[model samples]
Target: LSFSLPKCDTMERFAGRVTVYSVVGCPHCNSAKAFLKGLGLPYCEVDVEKDSTVRQKVKELTGRSTVPQIFFNKTHIGGNDDLQNLVSNNGFFSPQIKKKKKNKPSDLMIPSIPCFTDVKGERDNFAELILEFKSSGIIKSHGSFLKVHKLTFSGSELIEWLVDKKGFEKDQALNTGKELMQKKFFSDVSGKGDFQDGHTLYRLIEHDCLTALNSGKTAECSPVLAAELSEALRRLILKLYGEHLSPDGKTVDYKAMENSQTFQEYCELATQLQRLELKSMTREEKLAFFINVYNALVIHGHIKMGPPKNLWQRYKFFNGVSYLIGGEVFTLQDIENGVLRGNRKGVGQLTKPFSQGDQRLQVALPEAEPLIHFALNCGAKGCPAIRSYSAKTVDAQLKTAGEAFLEGDDGCHVNSCKNEIRLSQIFKWYKVDFGDTNEKLLQWVAEHMADSPKKKELKELLGKGNHKVVFLPYDWSSNSKD
Candidate 1:
């Protein structure tokens, strides 16, 4: 592909690093500095006038008394005039890519491209997005560069993913990827490895891949290369907002969260997610997707209209605002009802389906997985702690979430002395989803709590069939961390 480098006085843009040592009140030094600056060449400036020691050091190194000593990526070139002559006569600015072997992989036939950071043209925001992915640990280092680990993507796939992620036009996405590869921000390391064979694998050469790999303490090694959208978003959430569970076990710092840059970024991502093709996504992907949407909407919706006074107030906000997906609009009610829960009228009555709302919405899952009650965050004091969910491990994750929620009094309570049990309002609200009666709910809870000591105690108590069951009052107070 053809590429253009931003023009300097007599040469195109320089890709490598530059260092300049200069003294004050030197016209040649000033001119040389201005020339580099105008070309958008990044450089390090060392003032020799203020530090005579540096002057002596430069003299010893270059064996010259010149005030303006220039170095292109540590290679010394003579003063202002000499620099111009080198640029005009020699190809000092442009570096060539090494050719591939004769038997290159078919999938990786896209010619080896360089990084985009060195390019001089206007870059799209997608470049920034890719960098964000890099910093968030989504993109990892491979060999001399960094790449989206565990996955290989073509330039077209990269374009589509970015377009969906940022809600950009298809052509704009294509241009962004092209520019990144052309400028060398993203490098085409196509024929590097057997795993990468036949795939257009672009490596991010700017970041030290080893450094990112070594830095991970909490990062689990996934066998796969690129994670699904759910996993990607999960990693971002964990890195940014984190699972800041409350010591009180009931409150979230909503005020601080609402003001955080992470939350703002989440809002942007969530908006783009609405435009993504939900129908085409996998069941696990859809489950993880809607959960993220629900949780994010809870944070964003509250930010739009302060914290609610009661649970009903929160419901009002959810109903008032509609979220978009695949060029269609849906409310929170529609997501929970039509999409997730298969059009159930209410949580307590699964058989009775909702009569009103967007009927066009398809059920994201074949059937509503009841454990979702423990995974959905309502921004309420009694809601479950927010955790990143991955489509690949969502079943395990949901199981863990349910068990943790059930361990608390808000979800389940047992009184050995009175032979009685009290449960969270969730068991009462979504009785149909869990079971038709308290006994059924207890059995379901037992099924989830297996292999734990609590299960043995619950089983013994529940077996008596004489224990009283009561539902605790639902807490409506905001779960804001602040």
Candidate 2:
């Protein structure tokens, strides 16, 4: 069943009464979300890592700063397994969301533009535009593609108004427009023709479109744009991969890029590229830009050890297309590995103890334990759930991913009877976390299941007659990694 969270106005109803204290790096957060959804109970999710307010509140409430901390009608629902037990015994919520009210296509999706201006100009009317898509039933599944068309149009219209109403050369503006579209490192097919003078494209894509679309633009493009964007997006995902990136490999330090104060600088670079009159960049150029962003983000996500803000970079998903990387038209895997040249870290690493051996100026990726184990969707039955944000900054992405990890049941599956255990294959592959013993892992799982009837069942299952454990086989087949 599909369920969206409660919005701002109604959020207070979820506060101390039933708020969930979660950090971004835990997968259990997502599962908590899903669990709550299953029970039809609405909750307010505060990313403790991202939101200081929530962090402070959580520390005061739980005394600990971890994630997937849930508060029911008023009591603490605990973490993933805790919530799972709540679900098993029927205590998580009162009901599922009143069957989602029919949605309008025009209300499909609203691009949440990143507020990055020193002084805001006439912002493109993003709010009004959404009504159009929602009027259409695009409850807008998957990536908000419906909004992409509007983004393209909105960007183009803004650019046109800027050029015609503001007096800019048509040719230069059009080229500038192309550059802006290219800058997303994503495709801008529909808006291509509209920004011929470069100015139109520039005005809308940069000031109007990109800003308005913020992190939401990628999901709204057309099939062509979607294909191009996904391909472009996947290209760089390779960069974030680990040294030993095998289904069977242990966690590798796939350091994604670090956060910088030079975000505006990147925007300027896009403008410069536009002014260069670099005729429509070739497919290779487009692909290159996408890869550049994807790789940078992936590397950052891996090293940070958390969830990617954007869902795509969290997991390596290459739906149906394949691209030529390094030399061959490598699937996502080769491209990911291609990022690695000499050391375990990859080409540009300079940290001595780590990769290049230079640690002074280094800002290691935070922690990706969350996303790798949870957020990135791999089409696998149990792969992590991809989110709405972009994994542009690995640190932020990893934190969000981590939140989802600790919150989901995938990592620690409590049996139907609550007596036995079925943990993720990751626990087996990376057995060190559990003190090198199933008993230890079982002990840990028992903590979350502490007050539940499942605890009795689990203790009975493992300690009683059988004295046996069933290791749930992981789904190694999907994730569209290639």
Candidate 3:
């Protein structure tokens, strides 16, 4: 049988209620249960000895054979010492839960272009255009014009767009368009010609263009834009002092990151990115850009200030340095919440899309990719390993990273013998991003681990979704070089 916490809407639901597992004649268990009664709190007492199943389950769930184990809304608040500490910290009052507000129509009304309907050929053509853009990393010429969100390319540009953006290594990109033209997606001068001259241009049928763009799910910003930034940072890290993932996959070499030349070069890149026309970037580019920027700035912060000695100091690290981007100064939190996480209302983050038309927002990505949690590194031992992200392969790369991280002890621990699964606190904090519930999360884990050794075990646990998912306590120690 499986057991998990019931979903509660308010802190009031658990305010006066508690649970304790104990033995029939233990003084400590009696005192703990009595303490709850003294506070006028309602509680259920389970005699572990009476039910061997509960006894074994409790042992596996708490990693302890002793009782009285206590709980509030399924949150394991720990034993006697932990109980007293909780009371001392907040006078025995449970923390407040902020209610999520209802969303309105106005909030949901995002700007969108029209979608193609009743025209399979047009849809196919548009799909090809998006695929072409994906393979080619070159920016559409005519300066600042591509930023306007229209596809207007010269004949010559189409060849490179196909070869570069679409990864056309085997097929002839030039002839592919000719084959597509028979499908009626493209048009030449007066609707007929052998493609030639500066005047010859390929354009998408302009009907609800944004809708068409949205349907493709292709990133608007050139892959080159994201690739350039990744390469730049990669070069700096490699040239100054090489960086490597630790054996535990949790630490980085701090001394290597603090190279003066590397720090200086990063500062320039940071400033340069800020000054660029970032507002016009596509959703994929924005995601790639900010991920790189956040990771880079984090490394820069460490190098400049040395490693933060404590959790308080690490948080303050973001507060200490303010980098200028897009004519505005941003702290590390701003990029994290404002840009990548989309700062949705009722989430306790500042309410505002970091930039207008940013595709990273929840409205755009809908369910944000949870794998991103494993892709971004916050310079903490518990954080995911740092990696270069590009628009071209960000999605696939994140999946790979997520799998690698889970394979490590720092990210996941499964004890089939004990019937327990321990995961990083990231799963706890961003539960919604992963599937909004533990059951769904387990399904996701099972699906992603199809090729992993744990596949069979996870599959066996499928409908039984009752397994406990305990988030291991986060370690805030510096993950830098010794």
Candidate 4:
């Protein structure tokens, strides 16, 4: 068979912790801080001015200079305005993926290439992003960094998936990709809006491999590295790509990945990654592990759900949604099944991503919504910001994920003036899941927000001491692509 969907697929782990950074005096910084505290969150704050050298160094690392500069796990969620957007939307409130975090990273090899004038230079180097992963007395690295993707799918496939399924058009996908790719190019700490995206980087990188496959062009970068990465990409495609034809749909024997080097390595690593039992893991490790499991499980859940949302990458599937996990078609339902419940697959079980927070590792769940919300991509607009960093340990990854989620619209706090203050339906739909009473829930919510009619509305509802939060509809639109 050229290609066919597997009968089943399984995903493990779900949810993760979060991390944040801010300056002392800045109002935005103060707001960000007060808001997180209102959410009953534990964060690490640094005064950029107190340590002059540190400020300079932060500027250098993330490639910018700004106060109240922040990072959500790996994704740079931008400043206060950006964070407000994350909370404003019905960010990642379901079995669906939240578009909490994602940014345009420049081609690391492309600093030599100059971009158009439209792209802004990054203001704050991502010192906060990196520091949150391993701040003293905060969380430490208790998890391992791991890359779960097969590097399959191309810009075209990604574009189609995002445009058709996730609600973006070709230009939207292309434009966003350009911004993110641009960030990776210069290793710019800031996003691509600062960096120029008007011009295409397609021509800059070596197009030999893609050219052969008729893959079109990429941007300028290290010719050698581009060529190497291109070859790698091609190999990744060949190795991971799958296809199947249906002539009246005669069932063909589906072939599973057979002893592939990378696949085996991934499987083995996953084996080790999924078995933490929460004891050995540091606080950080637990968070990362859960986030990884959550992310992978989300992908698995969508597949097992019987219908694909067509939001995330589709090149990895056989039919519109045809991949196997465990022995049956995998779906979000199946993925969710693994949560709180144990799955035979090394996933689901909390050997690595611990739900329980450990005081020793300087980490705690702290209602740990932001990290998991952001790190795990659910193909939505309100999720956390996704970062470029590949999580190794569950703790660090989850912390990063948490931060990204909060930084994005999905976080508990967001701009009322802009979001139109529709309390996330999550509160209403699963009001009981939030807290004892409306007051309790509002108290919890107050932890993340400053004040406004939105907060007042919530307070009014919560003050009534009712657990019935108004149902806010979830936006299923995938955050990726666009």
**Candidate with maximal lDDT:** 1
By summed lDDT, the worst window of 10 consecutive residues in model 4 runs over 3-12
Q: List the residue pairs that clash in candidate 3.
A: 113-211, 114-208, 135-164, 135-165, 135-166, 136-164, 136-165, 136-166, 254-481
Per-candidate TM-scores read: 0.49, 0.32, 0.48, 0.31
- Residue-level lDDT of model 1, residues 228-339, one tens digit each, is 4333444344333333424323344556666677665554444343224455567777777777666655656665676778557766665655554433445666667666
**What C-alpha lDDT does candidate 1 achieve relative to the native structure?**
0.55
Local distance difference test scores for all models: 0.55, 0.38, 0.54, 0.34
Model 4 residue 324 CA deviation (Å) reads 12
Instruction: Order the candidate numbers by lDDT, best to worst.
Output: 1, 3, 2, 4
Candidate 4: segments with Cα more than 4 A from true spot = 1-284, 300-307, 310-375, 387-421, 450-470, 479-482
Error of 4 at 406 (Å): 6.0
Q: What's model 4's overall lDDT? A: 0.34
- Candidate order, TM-score descending: 1, 3, 2, 4
How many clashes does the backbone of model 2 have? 101
- Model 3: per-residue Cα lDDT at residue 101: 12
* Most TM-score-accurate candidate: 1
Q: Tens digit of lDDT per residue, candidate 2, span 1-482?
A: 01122233443433323456653323456556666666655565654444344454554565443566765433455666666664445453323211121221121111222321221123223323333332433222122555433433334453454467547576655565455444332233332443343322222222233221122221222112222333233322322221223332223322212233233223222222211211233333322333343333333333333433343642333311223211112222322222211112221223322335322112222221212333344334455543323233433444544443433456555564545566776556444434467787666556543233545666667665444455667664432222
Alpha-carbon lDDT of model 2: 0.38
| Model 2 Cα RMSD, 1 decimal | 18.1
